[model samples]
Each structure stands twice: as C-alpha cells, then as structure tokens.
Target: MDAALFAKSLLLGLAIAAPLGPIGALCINRTLERGILAGLAGGLGTALADGVYASLAAIGFAAFSDALARIDMPLRLLGGAFMLWLGVREMRPAPPRAPAPVRPRDLLGTTASTFLLTITNPMTILAFAALFAGLGLAATSSNADAALVVAGVFTGSMLWWCCLSGGVALARHRLPPAFARWVARLSGAILIAFGLAALLTALA
Candidate 1:
C-alpha cells in the first residue's frame, strides 16, 4: 500500500474541505439547529462528491471529466435553482421545538441536497484536476493507488465534518434561540447569493 500517497490525499481532502464556503455554512447551521446527525449527513454528501471528482482525477478518467464538462451548464442551473429554493425556505424563523431523534428521511434528504450542490459546482472537478496534476498523482497512479487515494480523500473529508459538527454540538448550548435564528438568516442569505451568482454565470 502506498501509505504516503494515502496520507497526502487525506490531507488534501481536509485542506479542501476546511474552507468555510456555502456548504460549510449550511453544515454549521444544521448542527446548531437540527443536531450533529443532520450536519454530519450533509457533510458526508459533500465528501462523496469530493471523492467522485478526486477519483476521476487520480485515475485519469478524462472521458468522464469531459462529459461532466459538457453538461456543466445544465447541472449548474439545476443546482442553483435548488439552492435558491433551499435558502428561501431556511430563511424563515425556526420555531422552537424539542430536539427529537433524527429521522431517516431527513438525513437522506439532507445528504442528497448537499451532494447535488457539491457535484454541480464545476469548479470542484477543476480543482481536483489541478491538484492531482500538481501533486504528480493524475498520470502516475495505478488503479489500486487511485482507489486508495479516493478512499483516503473521503475519510479525511468526513473526519473534518465530524470535527466541525462535534465542535458545534459542544457549543450548541451557548447559542440562544434568537442568536441561532439570526445565524440561520445570515447563512440562508449567503446561500441564496451564491445560487444567484451561479445561475447568472451559467446564463452568461
């Protein structure tokens, strides 16, 4: 096993995911409002998306990359529409309710939503392509190494999510309901803006 390659890939995943983008904001908001399970589920979806692109790059799947690029505009539009809808829905003030056990459907929906967002972002694949090439991993890696690298990327990305959700869970108590509501509003607005930008870019 190429342990060094695995470690590098893992770190790369962590580094990529650590940035507080729209997805990060969503995860944090979910953690504060819905609980750790919701946040982790959302985060896992993003990890899977990252794994898909990283795997394609590491294994040099040029055909799939080209195909994705071909349909990028449509994908962006769909993702943007979904994001706008979600943002508007979330912008409403959350009603205070007792914390209940997480439902399977909720987790599934949350994960699927984030997955769609991540996969539709054209920049994600390009980022992986550039990173894999710069790290000399795109052309030189074997299938086995590629598989390992992909696995590492997923694991590392999930690890970051776990940490983020856990940390937020710990501080979940400190945030008052009013403050949480404000956070939700801000996060929702951010997501809406990002969605609008993506839509405009696609239309352009």
Candidate 2:
C-alpha cells in the first residue's frame, strides 16, 4: 500500500465522518449518560460499517453501487425519518426517578444499534464508490492495498469519534445537572433540525 494513498484515504474518511449527524448525536448522548467507553464502542461500530462500504467500493462493485444510487432517495427518506424519531425520543422529559446505572450490556446495545443504523443507509456505500472512483482508488486490485485502505478508513472514523466523545465528556463536569439536562434538550433539538433539513433536501 502506498503511504500517500493511505494518508489521503484516511483524511477523506475522517472528513466525511466528522459531521455530527444522528449517529454522532446518539453517541454523545450515550457518553453523557453512560461514559466515554460506551460512546467509543458505538463509534467503532460505525467505523466498521464504513470500512465495509469502503471495501465494496475498492472492489469496484459497480452493480452494488448502482443499485444503491437507484434507491438513494428512499433510503435517505427512511434515514431521515429514523433520525427524527430518535431525536424526539431523546428530547422526551426524563422521569423524576433516578436514572438507571450504565451496564456493559448497554454499551453493546448502543454499538449494535448504530452499526445497524449505518449499515442500512445505502447512500454511504454510494458515497464511498464515488469518492474512490474520483480519487483513482477503485483501480486498486491488490488485496493488501485494499486492506490498507479499509484500515485507514477505520482509523479515521475512530479518530473522529474519539475526539467528539472526548470533547463532550470534557465539558460534562463543568455543567450542573440542570445545565446538562438543558444541553441534552438542545442536542436533541439540533438533531431534529438536521433530520428535517435532510428530509427537505431529499424531497427537493
């Protein structure tokens, strides 16, 4: 694997994944409610999904990419709806009762949910396909090179998630319980707004 190519791929993957979309929002919420490790687990799940798509693109799976492009709108609509639902669920008033303790199982659940959510969005695959083609990366026939590209993608994604989760966690202590609750509400609202924007863009 060429070092320059690997670096380029890693940078591109990080740029694409750094956006604070629904998955990021969920990760942040989990980190705030549970801990940074839980959020990192969720981010790893997303990175795995991205690597899968990157592999598909690197292999020049034109049929698969074409199929994803064909159904892109519907997929975006579904994703947008799901994001909206998640935002609303997050924003709901917390009961006066004490919050439940974070469990190991909860980390696994968060990871699985984000992984499934990301995998179902075929647009991600198409985006990868286009990006690989544009960068002349689709012509890579060597398995080693392909593996390196995939690894780069995973590294880039993990870096973004780590930064995001860490940044959020750092601010966790500065705020009181009331402020934290308000932050949660604001985050939920921002997620909903992004969902609406995505839905509108798709419809348009």
Candidate 3:
C-alpha cells in the first residue's frame, strides 16, 4: 500500500464528510437528544456506507454502477419519505427529562437508520469515483492500494464524526432544556426542507 495515496484518501474522506448536509444535521440532533454514543453510532453507520461506496468506486464495476443508477429514483423517494417522518418526530416537544440513556438496541437502531439514510444517496458513489479518478488513483492504484484507500476513508469519516459528536456532547450539558428544544426544532425544519428538496429533485 502506498502511504502517500492512503494519506491523500484520508484527507479526501474528511473533505467529503466535512460538508454540513443532512448527515451533519442528523448527527448533531442525535447527539443533543440521545448523547454522544448515539451520535457516534449514527456516524459509524455513515462511515460504513462511505466505505461501501468507496469500495464500489475503487472496483469500478460497471454492472454495480448501473444497478445503482437504475434504482436511484426509488432510493431518493424512500430517503425523502424517511426524512420527512424523522423530521416530524424531531419537531415534537421534548419530554421533561435528561437525554435518554443509550441502550444496545437503541444504538443498533440509530446505526441502522443512519446507514439507510446514507446508503440511499447514490450520489455518494459518484462523488467517490470522481475523486478517485481526479487523483489518478483509479487508473494506477493496485488492489492493495485500493483497499488501503477504502480503509482510510472509513477511518477519516469516523474521526470527523468523533470530533463533531464530542464537541456537541460537551456543550449539551450546559444548554438549558428550552434552548435545546429550540435547536431541535430548527434542525427538524432544516431536515424537512432537505427532504422536500430531495423529493423535488427525484421528481424532476
């Protein structure tokens, strides 16, 4: 494995995840509502999805790519609907209690939900493919190097999530319930808007 290529892939992963999109919002909201563990679980799910996409891109399988394209519209619609439901649930008033304790089942559910959300976006594979090609890794990298790149991406993505969730969790204790509730509502609104946009794009 080329250390330099792996390092570059790590940076690329960080850059890809650094954008404050639906995933970021979801992570923050989960952290604020259920604590850092929950947020990390969500991040883990996202990282796994990222790794999956990276592998697909690295392999450059036309059949796999074509399959993703074929179901793109359905995936978008499903993702949008799920987001709408999640946003509505988030908008509800928080009960007068501390953030819920993270149970094993809760973690599983959180991870699975975020994984589903991340995987639904077929664009992620395109983004990875573009980045790999732009870096010339697609044409030159060996199988081992590609594996390293995939690992690097997963590591980098998880690292970012750790930082984000940790930062939010640290501040969570200081914020009053009302303020937290307000943030929740705002995040919910943002999520709804994203969902609507996704639906529109899919329809268009």
On lDDT, the leading prediction is: 1
Please give the lDDT score at residue 80 for candidate 1. 80
Q: Candidates' TM-scores?
A: 0.91, 0.81, 0.89
lDDT-best of 2 and 3: 3
Candidate closer to the true structure by TM-score (higher is better), 1 or 3:
1
The deviation in Å at residue 132 for candidate 2 is 3.5
In the range 1-204, model 1's lDDT, one tens digit per residue, is 888888888887887688787788889888877899999999999999989878777766576567777988997798788778878977985775545688999999989988988887655655666666566566544788888889888988899999999998888887776766877788789779878977998999
What is the Cα-based lDDT of residue 10 in candidate 2?
89
Q: With candidate 2 superimposed using the best TM-score fit, by how many Å does residue 73's alpha carbon deviate from the native? A: 3.5
Rank the candidate models, highest TM-score first: 1, 3, 2
Identify the runs in model 1 with alpha carbons over 4 angstroms from their true place.
Answer: none
Evaluate all candidate structures by whole-model CA lDDT and list the values in order: 0.81, 0.73, 0.79
- Between candidates 1 and 3, the one scoring higher on lDDT is 1
Report how far off residue 102 is in candidate 2 (Å).
3.0
Give me the displacement of residue 179 in model 2, in angstroms. Answer: 3.6
lDDT of 3 at 76: 80
Please tell me which predicted candidate would have the highest TM-score against the true structure: 1
What shift in Å separates residue 73 of candidate 3 from its native position after superposition?
A: 1.4
